[model samples]
Target: MEKRFNKIVTLFAGLGLLVSCVSENKIEETFGVKKLVDNCVEKTILTINGLTDADSLPRNILQGQAEWNKVGIHDWTSGFWPGILWYAYEASGDSTILSNARKFTEPLYGVLDVPVDNHDLGFMLNCSFGNGYRLTKDSAYHDFLLVAADSLATLFNPKVGTILSWPAMGEKMGWPHNTIIDNMINLELLFWASKNGGSHDLYDMAVRHAETCMNTLVRPDYTIYHVAVFDTINGHFIKGVTHQGYSDNSMWTRGQGWGIYGYTMVYRETGNEKFLDLAEKLADKFIERLPEDGIPYWDFDCPSIPNAPKDASAAAVAASAMLELSTFMKSEELTTKYKDAAVSLLTRLSSDDYSSKDKNKAMLMHSTGHYPNGSEIDASIIYADYYYIEALTRLKKINEGRRL
Candidate 1:
């Protein structure tokens, strides 16, 4: 009887060890997150080393070296570089990455000194200070972000029922009140502020903006317009058009990715079924239209299908959003479908086809920033790396059964 008991105990112990080994791998080796994370850490250091000024943030890498987003140089993308560091720190558990993240993050405090006339503050601060606050639990970061949230709310025209995306650009284009699809990304900041310590009205404002966009921005086919214009006095949507898209009728991949991520986050924050439904719809439309490799062209209607520049940035955001969205699915089939789609995107991006391992310091390549403006075409964009790391981290958290 003693011998039989010992044998059973040994069997159970072996099973426990197997489970531990599996659990230790936050991502499956087949998925390549572990390798990619190490690469991300190394590349992040390389990116910082290339920078000469602390105030200038790394933005893109088109070829041999890195580019920057400065005070006036595509400053909307400023937050992503620091955001990448934070995510990299979380993945690698390296204190050096933490210090680097804080170093790049503090310089953005200068953003508060200037007037907040544009909606990009959310893109600028939330990705940097917002992640910092979440990870460090620093009250100062929270307070700074609250001020930014308040500043963002100032642009919300109750008349238009949406946060104005471009205040100065509206003047340039003769738009009374213009709201772009990218404004959807900013709603997360408002939602986070409402739950943390700021006014609950911030939550309400986010919901209102989302609902308004749902009604005007999304078209009948479910592909959305890039920009929606509203009459400032009457508070009615005037027309939908394109600024960065191939045409007024074409769906821009990155804008669609923002809508997918924004609605997914709004659903998480509000528990509203409508937002979930919309996110699912947007996600479905995006997934069905993707190319064979799952990375999207800059525009679905670009007139050059097989040859159009792929937007790895779009793929990164969609994968991250879908991973989170998968947890919210009510059905197992829905969950699997979304997760599989996300995995397909991540796998392709993690593969040699997209990884910028030997080519450049950036994690992934071939992202389209603004094709119509002829900017950052087929380049290594900073935000793409940020979201790619974030998606991998989300995969890790999901494996650990932790909250995202």
Candidate 2:
């Protein structure tokens, strides 16, 4: 046991060294943000292009494009990569990137518009159609978004006041009565639809569901449960379980990050003091436990495992959330602190060791998808890349106004 503990200590110490090295070499070169964004856009486009071949799909980290041909075009996960590409293109204003994103995403128009009862409509249409609207100001994207929103609203259960997770994956692995922290992201699309589509019912339903989640799923300490099982008949909370984390009560880092940002967004949309309060509370807990380098382990309170590593993706996601929270706050000092922390985290990630220049890797590094179940760890994830770019974009816009 002593030997194992020593190994864990050594691993953390090595990671601490990497953090120090990155901080020492923080790149202050002009246009560094733009360059990183451009690199991510270019690499992601190439990755999508490569996945067109069957042999390359399994090896492809992002959703494998070759799966599209075999499984047909409606695959949900396949849309996320191109969706992110569209987002990056919109942010950077590169016509080529936009063109590539359209080429990759246009096929999904038929699939997303087909009235499917999937939980991932937000994942599919929001990133693609939503981004297309943001980029091109095309009414078609808005129309698709409203259509998808209407389809999503069909999943809402009046008893639970939340969207059902999926149709019925089956009894053994079923989550029909389950609500997850990740679903908070999907609610954003509902909020958007409510505003733009002129549906007060949609808006009210989204708010009520968000309130239900806050009451049941979020702990007093601000750590979030991965899933909450509700008694549909009684309209009461039954129990909490970890669908993705290590255990029932473990604080999954990314899930917490989702809560942090999701609540802030809710506050933004509704002007609800409770949502803002929850966002601040969750942010406090998250920042308090983060390592000195700003990244966190997959679970905040988990026992360390050999070869299991920290997740920079969670850090990147939380940093973006912090920036959002900073803007919402009235205190200048607090805002500056949050902004500085975000910049520090992103600067560390952009270092040579973490941010791979190779087109194949395509992300700022040290992302862990799932550690307890032995999934991708210390690897580049698409969401990590997405949030990393989002952070940089936020920083660039802020710095531009401040002018050093």
Candidate 3:
């Protein structure tokens, strides 16, 4: 049903383009969308090729070490690097980029068949195989995504009303049921799976998990908790806490970005007005608190304030989400506001101060990953680049008279 609906929308979009006589070049000239995308692709190719002569690609560039770090397929972030390569190929039609994307994506096949904990299977599979299927319409890619969606659904707890994020590895910190804001990004895989002929149960699990997140993690002011613990046995809410933020009550910048992205996605899949409202509220809160550069600090409540490290990754994620959210909005005022805010944020990320000087390194800098653990602080993270490219693609689609 969803597929049929999308086909109709596509038909109408094509008719509209024909009627308006809007060529791709005209749209690109008006928005400079293709120019920005071309720049990103050039930077990505240079950075990726420069990272290694070996088969492995860099997960991230460690600025202090002046080297790139690689991770295995099971790693939470393994999918994004290849996913970026696919995007590059899509934009440029470069045969070398396509070959590299295929090579990098081949290693990720293990993720579909293996058992893994953590809620990032969506990130792992969706970015790689998800994009692969979208572009090539390969049956193998579709089958793998189905397998991965089933694998991800195994973590969902009916009692807890959410997918368990972390396993009970540590007695002090790990609970039987723990959900994180990052899990929200994974739900897209579930929704796609169900709509594409997977189980209705997977779709139901996603909706329930989203509702539980909104109830437990989202605060009145639109800030979000990094973690939500539940008593799985009794189906009771235990506590809200922070593992990566400044403190338990403080707002982690990336968590807020996840909220904005996640809820906007829910609105997209479900057409729920309340979810759209929540996404817009979170976007406003995030934009309202931005520093002068339109980027965000590592944590909203960080004591360093003006001295805190900027998280260009969070800004990228939120900007991308806002762009998509704007497409669903009915009010012209809200749409323009969100669109302008996303443009401002992306402009900051593309500026000389935030963008890497050397084309052979990470593109956008100043990302904070696991700050409380003292890992990847103020460095360029892979997922940041992924979302930045995604945002640009979305904007380009919008300008070309298409849906986001």
Global lDDT of each candidate: 0.87, 0.73, 0.86
**Which residue pairs come into collision in candidate 2?**
none
TM-score of each: 0.95, 0.83, 0.91
**lDDT (tens digit, per residue) of candidate 2 on 137-190:** 788778878877888888888898887765563255554477788778788788
Q: What TM-score does model 3 achieve against the real structure?
A: 0.91
Tens-place lDDT digits, model 3, residues 1-404: 99999999999999998867767657655557788789888877876676553236567776665456877787888888888888988889999888778878888887756666778999988999899888888898899899899999988889889988987532657665889999999999999999887999998999999999999999888889999889978778888899999998998999999999999999889988889999999998998888776789999899998998888899999989999988888989988899889888887887888887573367688898888889888888889989999998888887766876
Which parts of model 2 have CA positions greater than 4 angstroms off? 1-32, 48-76, 113-117, 173-176, 305-307, 401-404
In model 3, which regions exceed 4 Å deviation?
A: 1-31, 51-55, 64-67, 169-174
lDDT pick, better of 1 and 3? 1
Full-model lDDT, candidate 2: 0.73
Better of 2 and 3 by lDDT: 3
Q: Determine the backbone clash count of candidate 3.
A: 0
Write down the TM-score for model 1: 0.95
